[model samples]
Target: MKIAELGADGTEQAYDAMRQLRPHLTSAGFVRLVNEVQRPQGYRLVASWDALSGRVVAAAGFRVQHMLAHGPVLQVDDLSTIPAARGQGHASRLLAWLEREARFLGCAQLHLTAGTHRYDAHRLYLRHGFAIRSFQLSRQL
Candidate 1:
């Protein structure tokens, strides 16, 4: 198993894996959207590849920023592992990597919002030491 920061060269593989988690995005728009988010939001992508097959099985989209609540934080906007690859520790490995990266960048916290219905993911986060500190309320504008 190998974890790597994805660049343009890994975009296609990353998109294919990430699409499983965010099916609303079309292939044509994925790259464009990632680029747009990166420029203004400090967005980044990382992927985990199987050691033998060498296929990207998991992906994460995140950024580092400062906010009043947390001075410098690494906030994960998206994290997904292809269904077939679940339970293989791909996401866990990625999360660990992110934590290390966060510390290296002087981030005080790591944060993410999971949909209420995603019970399994919530379990994973809880096991990783994340507490449910607040509810994230949103409305369509």
Candidate 2:
């Protein structure tokens, strides 16, 4: 599997894997988010592709931000893999890649949030040395 940052030309290729995580997002909306919303904040789309089939099997959307609490850290906004691609280490590979990127960029830590019910995701994070820091709360306007 090849893990790399995707450019505008590869946005379309990332849609399917992204959709596995964001089921409500339309392809167009995702493209716009990547180009407009995320790009402005220096967000990046990283993906793992199936070498033989040339398909994106997993994807991680992330950005580096300076927060009052954490200072500069690589914050992963979304991370998911196609169902068929699970257990193949794609997500782990993406995490490893992101860790390297965060270190290279001088980030103090790598961060991400996962839903409480996502046991598998939580397990993966725990295995990767990520601990439950604090509860993440959100409200809709």
Candidate 3:
């Protein structure tokens, strides 16, 4: 397994894995959105690829931000491994890579949000030494 940043040629492969997790994203719209919004804001899409199978099995979308409260931090916006790819340590590997990147960038913290009902994900986070420090609340306008 190899983890690499998604570039132009890897779009479809990256989408295949990510779409399973973010089903709300349509292919065309995802492409357009990534070009129009995500890339400009420094969002990066990275994936764990199985070179032998020529497929992306896991993906993560992340970015670094500087905020007064946290100074510099790395925030993982999305993380998913295809159902078939779960339990294979792909997510764990990608997260470790991200943590190293965060440290390389001098980030003071790493942050991400998991849904309340995702108990398994919560367990994974805890296993990775993450602790709950705050709650995130949002409203639809």
Candidate 4:
């Protein structure tokens, strides 16, 4: 397996992967969002692909954003491994790649949110040196 940063040509693959995980996003909306993130001055989308089969097995995306407490932090918005490709260390490898990238970008810390029901993912994050920092609160508009 090889980890590659999704470039201009890799947008379609990244969109497909995200749509598979999040079916609610329409293709048009997803495309627009991808373009926004792929902008030269914005966030990055990194994916791990299987070299032999040419399939994207896992992905982790982050952006350097400012916060009151941390100043500049790497906010990981998405981390996903294809269902069929889980338990193969793809997620772990992608996370390792993200950590390196975060450090290289001079981020003060890495931050993310996991769903309350995703116990397995929570455990994985804990194993990776991420602690339960705080509860996420939100209200629908």
List of clashing residue pairs for candidate 3: none
TM-score of each: 0.94, 0.96, 0.94, 0.89
lDDT of 3 at 76: 92
Number of the top TM-score candidate: 2
Runs in model 2 deviating more than 4 A are none
Superposed on all Cα atoms, the candidates' RMSDs to the truth, in angstroms, are: 1.2, 0.9, 1.3, 1.9
Model 4, runs deviating above 4 Å: 37-41
Model 4 quality (TM-score) = 0.89
Q: What order do you get sorting by lDDT, best first?
A: 2, 1, 3, 4
Q: Write the per-residue lDDT of candidate 2 for residues 1-141, one digit (tens) a residue.
A: 899999877877888988988999999999988898778889889999998888999999999999998789999999999999899999999999999999999999999999888999999999999989789999999
lDDT of candidates 1 onward, in order: 0.89, 0.92, 0.86, 0.78
Residue 40's C-alpha lDDT in candidate 1?
A: 58
Off by over 4 Å in 3: none
- Which of the predicted structures, 3 or 4, would earn the higher lDDT when compared with the native? 3
Candidate 4 whole-model C-alpha lDDT, 0 to 1: 0.78
* Model 1, C-alpha of 25: deviation from truth (Å): 1.0
Instruction: Give a tens-digit lDDT track for model 3, residues 1-141.
Output: 899888754566677777876899998777777767887898888899866687899988899999999999999988888888888888998999999999999999999988898888899999999999999999999
